[model samples]
Target: MPNTASALELDAYLRLSRASLGEWLAAIRKISGCRDMACRLHNGGGPVGALSALESEQGFIVCIYASQGMDLTGCRTSDPVVLVPLGGEPQIARQGGRWQPLGKLIVARPEDRFHLRLPELGRVMIMRPRTDILNNLVNSNAGLPIAECHELIDCYLRRSLFFRDHNHARQMTSELFCRLGRIAREESKSGCDCSGLDRRLLRAVDKIRHEPDWDFNLTELASYAGVSERNLYYLMKRDAGITPYRLYQRNRLTRVRYRLVDCQCMVPHISRYAADEGFSHLGRFAALYREHFGELPSETAQWRRNLLEAESGHSEEPLAAP
Candidate 1:
């Protein structure tokens, strides 16, 4: 049976001081494709500099939290970010008058023009999924509203910076993606704020995402979405730039990628994990993973193993960004 156990705590690499914050900001700037964002800082005492960051890499999601140290007002980003507070009431500027108490989660859409005050020294986890992915998931959410996520958000962020084992991260990433798709589906149902084949494309992807091994033939999938295979093919080509099968294939590779980065002492065999995800062609799977993620599977797993080793020894080496 797969390990379902979990434990949690803080990892020291997450401790960001003012000086370290400067360094982090500088290094992140050097990363190509980093989004342009601007923040005006209002510190209670000195510059509000302490923050804890955890990025669930396989899912392309990030969680950053700040407590009583500083209140960031008039903060804006080009994309939508889900903000879940781990402590007190973190208020966005526009909703200052009626901000709810301890359990409110904010979906900071691009047009929100928001200001956030973090007085409780609470941790906030922000997940940034692709904009088009959000659009697809939103429209086809099958009537599940995003507002219902307050409790789920709390549960998701409870692990903080520490995940007890490798399987924990994989499970969290998969579960989070499903919840995000549901939230987006619910959010899109209410308004015309939209894009991408009106959810058919996203729905197909979501099916594959959650169950990579499910037998979803093209005809069955297309018919399920109330369209013929021919129309479905063109819609995917036009909107997502790929066929439904191709998208499913990619998601399968994603499952394999998660296993590749398992951070455990006795990591599972890469070939076995890949095959369990239905990849019989180990060489082809490795090549595809390399092409997509820019590294071989073994190398990725080793990097994580080394990271934990550094952490256990409390080596002051600069931590690698996920």
Candidate 2:
């Protein structure tokens, strides 16, 4: 066994520049489709934070920020996010400007708006899940969003810190979501029967991610998930709001986009890469890529290349304590 306390530090600083912190914050906001946030640090030294991420799209991002007294105004999310309290009581005001203490785990549904003021010298870990995934949890646990969110995460984090590696993180994350969806059935009044259905749905979803290149039909997916087509339809409709096929397509497209942005020059041609990922129709692939990433795949590749080039010469400086 080895200690990896320092393996996941993507960026570190003693006193971070507003612009530097903004770069990291903006990336998260952009990917999560969150806009309209104004952040100000509590202390004069400025916001200091560290970020760690996985290569695949399946993993959760872990960030630690020490900027309490940091007041954020006009914030909202286009995804479902869990705001975990790290150190002390955090002040969060949502819907209205009224501030209050953040409970155990604050679950913010997609499109939910909130204003937040971090406690003095407080730290927090935030996990943002896709809106569709959150919708499933919300549909099953409508009356207990926050509590359900907490327990779902508790099941996943019980093992160990997920800073191992990308492939490990991706596999673990896949199971994590499956287990999360599995919870829906257990919490339902139907109990085991519905829980079994939930498990089937997740199994189908996992099959999609595991074999994105496969042109999986609903019937095939249902078979793989160990459920009837009718029940599969019911589960997706009742929980995820999308068909099994839709999630498969999204998994393929999002993974392609992630590779375009992450792998860079290793993937020489965008069309070839897209086709390899099962997007056979270039015209349709370009359109879907634009719709999902807010730009063409080429643009994403170029932007990511620029970031990698910039980082080739970049140096990290540990932030000094105030």
Candidate 3:
């Protein structure tokens, strides 16, 4: 599985000191091969300096930033870029370029010295493709040259970053990357052909993601994918490195996390949320929610409410136990 960590966790691991901006930049440069990277400190009450990094491995590079507003300039290898803002707003400008009003999410590719002005503490995830892997995909797909590949990537990134239809963007990008990876792998082997089973597997995965609330069983999912139950199990194990049931649980849990942490919804309504995510049994849903998020459903909901109330300058009474 791909490694994942929150920005705060990654910042502590890197040990960035607020006292010295030069030292912080040096650390980022050493670790990420980021040359000419620098940020001017924003005069705010929050932390003076913060940085986080995520190793991509076979995935795309992801960086999370949360600091006071500042002007930023940097240059890395020529690669596609996507910047997703989780909070606040910022304006992004290319080198020697005009300023563009950047709202919730922004995606751009600047060959060098991309300029950005962040006015507040903002959380943004930056994704960049592995160049060699991307090039290989292009070479293997006869119709897609390196230039066309870059354009397609740019399109995907832009749509993902800017579109209000986040569900569509996420689904499309995930499918595109998986398809490209499979094509590249097959092209490297002799006499490899795309199988009917592969199409079925992809459809099955998509259905689970798009309709998590559906009453889907192993047999139903297998039939939907146009494969037998045994073949479905074998294919999921071979391709996704997990069983179909496990994948379903993971996806459902992920939705719960997004609601609890990202959306800051209340706990009493968690059962409803779980139902929306396809959990029909309250006991099983609560058990899985607690296991995945390390807290009872009610506790998670109260925590989010407290956070929301705090953010909104409202004093909220402590939530009673469920």
Models, CA RMSD each: 13.8, 13.5, 13.2
Cα lDDT tens digits for candidate 3, 35-151: 577767677343434444333234343443445677666745355454545445766777668877655333354464566666655545454545655555445544433333344
Model 1: lowest-lDDT 10 consecutive positions: 3-12
Q: Give the TM-scores of the predictions, in the order they appear.
A: 0.45, 0.47, 0.41
| Residue 238 lDDT (model 3) | 74
Candidate 2: where are CA atoms >4 Å away?
A: 1-21, 54-64, 145-164, 187-322
lDDT of 2 by residue, 1-322 (tens): 1111122222210111122345435543443335677667666544333333332244353444443357666667656666776555677887775888876766666455876676654555566654455555566644434555555555444322212222444565565555555555354321221223366777776687567557868788888888899998888767555667666665676556545543436344888878877888899998876654345676656554443444354524321111
Please report the TM-score between candidate 2 and the true structure.
Answer: 0.47
Worst 10 residues of 3 by lDDT: 1-10
Pick the winner on TM-score between candidates 1 and 3: 1
Error of 2 at 289 (Å): 28
CA deviation > 4 Å runs, candidate 3: 1-91, 94-124, 127-197, 258-267, 275-284, 293-303, 315-322
For each candidate, the alpha-carbon lDDT, in order, equals 0.50, 0.53, 0.52
Candidate of highest TM-score: 2
- When summed lDDT is taken over every stretch of 10 residues in candidate 2, the lowest stretch is 10-19
Report the Cα lDDT for candidate 1.
Answer: 0.50
